[model samples]
Target: MAALRAACYVPRVFTPDAVLIERGAEETPMARRCRERLPDVPFTVVEDRQAARVAIGDDFAAAKRRLVLAEHRGSFLGHCPAGTRGLRCCNYLMMNFATNCPMDCGYCFLQEYLAENLPLTAYVNPGAALAEVARVLDKHGDRRFRIGTGELADSLALDPLTDLSADIVPFFAARSNALLELKTKTDAIDGLVALDPKDRVVVSWSLAPEAAVALAERGTTPIAARLAAARRVAAAGYKVGIHFDPMIEHAGWEEGYRDLVATLAAALPAARVAWVSMGALRFSSGLRRAVRARFPGSPLLTGEQVRSADGKWRDFQPLRVAMYRLVRRYVEEALPDVPLFLCMETPEVWQRVFGAAPLGEQALGARLAAR
Candidate 1:
């Protein structure tokens, strides 16, 4: 790990000059690890976690980019894909190990979900939360629980300093009824690769074309580097997954995605892959203004988008179906047997794209668990 960090010149945004710790959380392993990363930084122990909001001040968007660490004193587990109703949900559980990404993509919902100017926080006590998860799993050992640690944060963005994956991977490896899916955009797989192989753990990546990544998803690993890391992990006996989520309708989008599918197919081991997911670029109507405000020249906002029945903005149904079909065709050619599912889309759209839909959320959950 030392040699890997020395060789990689990745600029870390989670390094804070001053860290605010919730009084009781100051002595945890996560906090100690954080303090070690910024050795000379000042530590302010606060009685309440919300009291640190003063440091956030008036401009939250601006403060979010700065290096400020906060110890979260809340539960780390959260409800994911299940919260959005009337759709084919995978019943995925969100492990809120961390919050607020260091990499600021233009379309991130963190802008709305997190308090403005809240420093990037890592919940130190996921052990307590995992105990609760264990209780639930203990009762339903026959059922599969697909939990992920990337809904609110890129699972590996702060891994070099925190070494969170080191603990997380092994914990999931011991569990038979659950799978820990570490979804990330960065190629921070060094710590992950060093660990023993865990068949129950899925290291997944959020992918886009090189062009779209540069335009919207900033401060992420290059597409080529990501695939290289995926290949390395697959060779190490881990089931890799890919997410073509937020599939942007950028210029030359069709050609770009087609080439991306070909690249992934040629480079990745299809048999070791768990599954692939697709979701078109969709957000709340209010988020359009925020996205525009954050990225003034971003072309993503200029593309065709409409408010669907779900009261969120998305490309027209036909255009979205067309994009999915094009990408699916290319991807299926490469990963012939891999399960290709949609994220947060209606059953009608599912039937249109895949010719069928899951009977219910539980049914979809069981299907993904089998994978």
Candidate 2:
């Protein structure tokens, strides 16, 4: 009898009306408990008792059924700009699979980004979005593509309940031309453990110093646990990736980051890595206010930041460059040949740090494909 994890009881945070709960035919002790607890909540009990009983252990069952909801058919994917809004635009694609996160990070942009107060909006139908992606790829077949699901949500946080990776992994596996990166802050990899570990699917995790994780990132899996999961996925033959985005500058920053990079190098060899990206903290004005309201104690929102041309607040240029340079040095020392990139940075910043302009997603995709 597995325990049931209720996502959120807050109406504004996670509208119960939007959630569709489907119970397995032969209800496990856990399911029975949930049914008893929320008798009024709408749910359909599976009639095929034998199959439902067996599916209780199947992690993908919930995610597979959730796909039946066809509400998000027309609107779910888009592009974001680089540097300033009117400046260079990075050809990035965002797959709006789900919204909000179960894990509460004080610095999360979702607090302001979401139109509704509800933290979770699971787009039940991914097939529709996939069809659109296929169309995009067919139209742009010659161009290499880099798209990620982590933009709108923690790609794999609810994976245990949704099994989205099981469906998404095979989709990308069939499409050799496009690269799909699943970035997460959790250790939920059971759904991906059995998938064919190919270059088409890059499993990535957001990393921060242990102190930061302890102080600000609430409900997220520990750094050690996340790295262990990454190690397991890499061992299973997948190209693993990491992001040190929103890198916080606190006391003993160098020692903290060095320890983090060292742990990563020890856990997985450089050969299994596809790429790693570094990004300093950047947030929209609305998002910064949300963070301050939700987490008044968080020091992340207290740093000296300025609004960039893109209308988002970020660390000053010199401080940002220093952070990037330090992380680049660490990666080069730890994994000499592994590819490194910067996220949402300016060409000037790129030239100063890496001696080259940041490559567009297509070129970045090509570079990864070539590797």
Candidate 3:
């Protein structure tokens, strides 16, 4: 029965080639779970992250196929990097329990950001990370904050092994000042649906057209599967967040997005949706090179993009604003009650799309946190 149960729980979302446990992490809850659940995968212990990287080699693509459970040094929390001086930022706080995602989304910025730390890693000490979060939330008790776990990695991608959500969910469920947003492109929510969030958590999915999913997002859950998983999550009492982020401009974008909105409306209950967001693809030179080398045939590279004030390449103001407006209209018409926002956009683009810009990130953060 023990063997049968372990076999039944083998992860269907991803199968790592190897499991690397960092020094002193071999006895961690996350490492123990990986040992039991990933029975067939090779497991090894290294001196530290550097040694693990050497063992994993320098190939970023190959490194992504391995899992590393290591100690997370330094502060685990920070502001979202996309909130640049010129962009009308959402004051989104980020707490990273992991540094890289296993999914190889061709256009992901982490391909460039995590070039230094190559392997897909989950921190072993989630308790310390949670304690840090509690301190921050308690210190800033007056103002509301929206904290997310998906900034550095897909929030739930390695959850089956790490069981990070099982710990973080109940922790946030007890907090009153902030909302925990678990964002991901995968349908790895088995650890999530079992937890009770007490309206304190939001499980957000990055919704994209199947064309873009096929073109750029490799190894992610299908749109249908993601929606079905989200429906299951909502049925368990957690609010849902929909993100049409990096909304790739493709051949039939308008029609594709319209279909996406219609499908999302039919599948997800509107009452369970807390927010909706859409942003056009924004690229940096580093990310562009990564995408070119990794996904040479990608249609994401075909768009005529210009460098924005934030030093990232994006569709010109008018083009992205139009994309936002159209997608916003579709979502609003379909699920009018849900609050919709833009991700990593400028004040001018916000103004163009909504007729007004948020007073600032603080005001926007407070508004979203209230929901």
Candidate 4:
């Protein structure tokens, strides 16, 4: 359980250019932590979240560096939007404590999804999210809710500044009906290990090859460091998950993935890994424009993708299936007993890989949510 870089490990800190606080959010716990932690950053109080967005002036990607603490008055927990009409949805759920990630991964959908939502926002009122979760779990007492907070933000990236997870981890640890999944591409687990999840939490990491990471995933933890952090978390008595999502079909991609899987298999023991999921690279045509404008040299734009039934451009079905089967084969050979699943994929693709698809998204979600 020794860390590869623990002695010299410095948490990848995210220091925003300025912190904008929405009027009533000033006294919120999240705002207080940011003020206390980021004493050097200038602070401004805005009338509302939209006003804070107007205060920050930068391109879409660069705008992410500005932190906006505001109140989210709407519902917090909802079904993941990744499920498309024809796809076999994982029945995943998402809770956004924050609205956007500080890291600028080239393929991040927020570039298009949140085109108007400029600044990275941390909803100062987390009690609302916890309350929403309690209500859902109360109603669905017969079911286990596997809720993830990373769909709209890097779950752990803002941990140092917001301390949101400290409150969330213990909350989920106390519940039997909820399984909180903290997914991230950062090695920011210092606050995590100090807590005991009691097996009600999963610390998951989304990974790509080291070279792919070096190119497009900016300001994130290296894959090696992520795996090392996973080991440490697993040793600390928490089950970890792996996501090889948005798997890019870059040149020499086969070799890249082969080596990447080997490294992951070596670091992640089967028993410690709760689940491993994969999704081929796919994005809306609008996001393609965003990626080109932001990262002109990104290799993600080089794939032979075609629009799928979901209306997003994805690798052609045949090629996508081939890549999944190959990676599935690699994982089967390496981590023989771990549960593997596909994310946001068609039933045809699911049938081709696993010989069958779930009865429906709810059935799939029920199966994965089981303790």
Best by TM-score: 3
| Candidate 3 ranges with C-alpha deviation above 4 Å | 1-11
- lDDT of candidate 1 vs native? 0.77
Error of 3 at 52 (Å): 0.5
Instruction: List TM-scores for all candidates, in order.
Output: 0.90, 0.80, 0.95, 0.94
**Decreasing TM-score order of the candidates:** 3, 4, 1, 2
Question: On residues 245-322, what C-alpha lDDT tens digit does candidate 3 reach at each position?
Answer: 988888798999999999999998788898998887888899998888877867787878899887888887778888
TM-score (C-alpha) between model 4 and the true structure: 0.94
List the lowest-lDDT window of 10 residues for candidate 3.
1-10
Whole-model lDDT, candidate 2? 0.69
In candidate 2, the residue pairs with backbone N, CA or C atoms under 3 Å apart (3 or more residues apart, or in different chains) clash, namely 12-118, 13-118, 13-119, 63-162
Cα lDDT listed for each candidate: 0.77, 0.69, 0.86, 0.83
lDDT of 4 at 289: 92
For model 4, how does the per-residue alpha-carbon lDDT over 227-263 read when each residue is reduced to its tens digit? Answer: 9999989988788998989887766778998998899
Best by lDDT: 3
Between candidates 3 and 4, which one is better according to TM-score? 3
Q: What's the C-alpha lDDT at position 34 in model 1?
A: 73
TM-score of decoy 1: 0.90
**1-371 per-residue lDDT for model 2 (tens digits):** 00111221111112132223233322433334334544555654443323333433332212222211113546677775452454433455778787666666767776676533332445556777888888888898877776789886788865665567777888888886788888888888887888884767889989998777765676677788789999988888778888897788888888999999999999999998888888878888888877777677568867788888778888888999988898899999999899888877777888889988767755765786655
Off by over 4 Å in 1: 1-18, 40-44, 66-74, 115-117
